[model samples]
Target: MHPRIRLELAKRWSEPHREHHDTDHLAEVVRAVDLLASSGMAFDIDTVNTAAWFHDAVYDVHRADNVERSATLAQRWLGPGEGDRIAQVVMATTDHVAATGDVESAVLCDADLSILGADTERYDRYAHAIRVENLHVPDAEYRRLRSRVLARYQARSELFATAAARELWEDQARENLARELTRLGRPVAV
Candidate 1:
C-alpha cells in the first residue's frame, strides 16, 4: 500500500465517534492477518491485507449500510480493479461468513473477528467498547438485539473459516460467546 493511502486510512480509523472499531481494532485485525500468514496459509497476503484496512473504514453503529459504504469507499479510494477486488473482501464482513474455497475472504473475516477469541479481560473490554459505541440504544433494547446477533454467531457450525484461525480462536470464541450470552441473561444457544 502507498504511504498516502495508509495515512488516509489511519485518519479515518481514528475518527472520534469510534469506540472498539477504532485504530487499535484496525491494528489488531492487521496483526491477526499477519499471524495467519506466518502460519504458511495459502491466501494472497496483499489482497487480504488491503481488505482488512478497508473492512470497517465506514463503521457507524447506527447505520445498516456500513458494509456497502465501506466497500464503496474502498473502490473510490483505490480505483476500479484493485479496489473492486478488495471491496469484494470488505463486503464479506457484512455477515462474517465466507463462501467455501474463498481463502482470502476466509482470512479477512477471521482476522476481523479475532477479538471474539481474546481472553476474558480483553474480550470484556471489547464488549464494553461496543456497548459504548451503541449507547444511543436503550439498555434493554441493546441487550435484546446484541443477544440475538451473538446467538446467530454461536449457532453457526464454525466461527472461523480457515484451519489456522480455527486452531487459534474457535474453542475460545465459543466459550467467550457462551459466557457473554449467559451474562446477558440469554440462554446460550448451541
Candidate 2:
C-alpha cells in the first residue's frame, strides 16, 4: 500500500462512528495474517495484506454492502490484478466463509475474525465498543439481535476455516463467545 493510500485508510477507519473497527482492528488483522503465515500457511502474502488493508475500508453500520463498496475503493487504489483479487477475497468476507480450497480467503477471513479470540480484557472492550457503535439500536433490541448473531456463530461446525486459526483461536473464541452469550441471555453450546 502506498503512503497516501495508507493514510487515507487510516482516516477512513478513524471515522467518528468506528470504535472496534478502527485502525487498531486493521493492524490486528494484518498481524494475525502474518501469524497464520508464520504458522506455515502458504498463500500470496502481498495480496492478502492489501486485502486486509481494504477489508473494512468502507465500513458503515447502516450499510449492508460495505464489502462491495470497500472492494471498489480498493480497485481505485490498487493495480488491476491485485484489485480484482482483493475484491474477490473481500467479498468472501460478506458471508464470512471461505471456499473449500481457497487458502487466501480462509486466511483473510480468519485474520479478520481473530478478534473473537482476543484475551478476555480485549474481548470485553471489543464487545463494549461494538455496542457503542450500534447505539442506533435500542438496548433490548440490540441484545436480542446480538444474541442471535453470537448463537449462530457458536453453532457453526467450524468457526475458523484454517487449521492454524483452529489451533490458535478456536478454543478461546468459543469461550469468549460463550461468555458473551451468557451475558446476552443466550444459551451457550456445551
Candidate 3:
C-alpha cells in the first residue's frame, strides 16, 4: 500500500524538470519512514510513509509555506479522518514545531532528521545536490540561507523524539549540524 502511494507521489512530483523534489529525496524519506517503523514507535506507517513521500512535492525554492501546500495535497489524497492525520505529519515536516506534535508526527520528524546521521561523504553530497537543485539562488544568498537553516537545525536538542532515534542519531546529527554550521561560517560558540 505504501509502495503504491510512493509511486503515486513520485509520478506527481518526481519529474526531470524539478530539482529539489525528486525521486532520490522521496527514496530517502521512505527509508527514514521504514527506520522509524522498525524503531517501535507507534505510528501509522502507511500514512506517515505516504506523507513523507509527498511532503516536499510542492516545494518552491523561494517560497516558505510549502508545508501548507504539502499538507493540502496530502489531505486531498487522504480525504477526511486519516487524511487529516497524514496532513498533520506532512505539516510537521514544514520547518514548524515538530517536537510538540503528535506521537506519529514526532516519529516522522525523527525519520526526516535521520539524514543528518548519514555518513559524512553522503551528507556532503546531499548538500551539494541541494545547491545544484537551487541553482537559481546566488552563492552568497545560498550561503546565508543555508547557514540560517543549519543554525536552526542545531538549535534543537529534541531533534529526534523517540528513544531509539535519540540514542542512535542524536550525536551524529549534532556533529553534522556542527560541521555544516562551520562550513557555513556560523559555528556554535565554544
Is candidate 1 or 3 superior in lDDT? 1
TM-score, cand. 2: 0.96
Against the true structure, candidate 1 has what lDDT?
0.92
Q: State the displacement of the C-alpha of residue 93, model 3, in Å, after optimal TM-score superposition.
A: 0.8
Give per-residue CA lDDT, model 3, range 1-190, as digits (tens).
3566657777767666565467776777788778777867677787777677767877677787878988888778767987787888888877735656477777677777777887788788777778887898988889998989888877775677788878878887788878887887775743
What's the candidate order when arranged by decreasing lDDT?
1, 2, 3
The candidates, ranked best first by TM-score, are 1, 2, 3
Quantify all predictions' global Cα lDDT against the true fold.
0.92, 0.90, 0.75
- Model 1, 46: alpha-carbon shift in Å? 0.7
- TM per candidate comes to 0.97, 0.96, 0.87
- lDDT per residue, candidate 1, 41-151, as tens digits? 988999998998899888888899988999999999999999999999999899998887889999999999899999999999999999999999999999999999899
- Candidate 2's clash total is 0
Candidate 1: stretches off by over 4 Å = none
Clashes of each: 0, 0, 0
Against the true structure, whose TM-score is highest? 1
Off by over 4 Å in 2: none
- The residue pairs that clash in candidate 2, if any, are none
lDDT-better candidate, 1 vs 2: 1
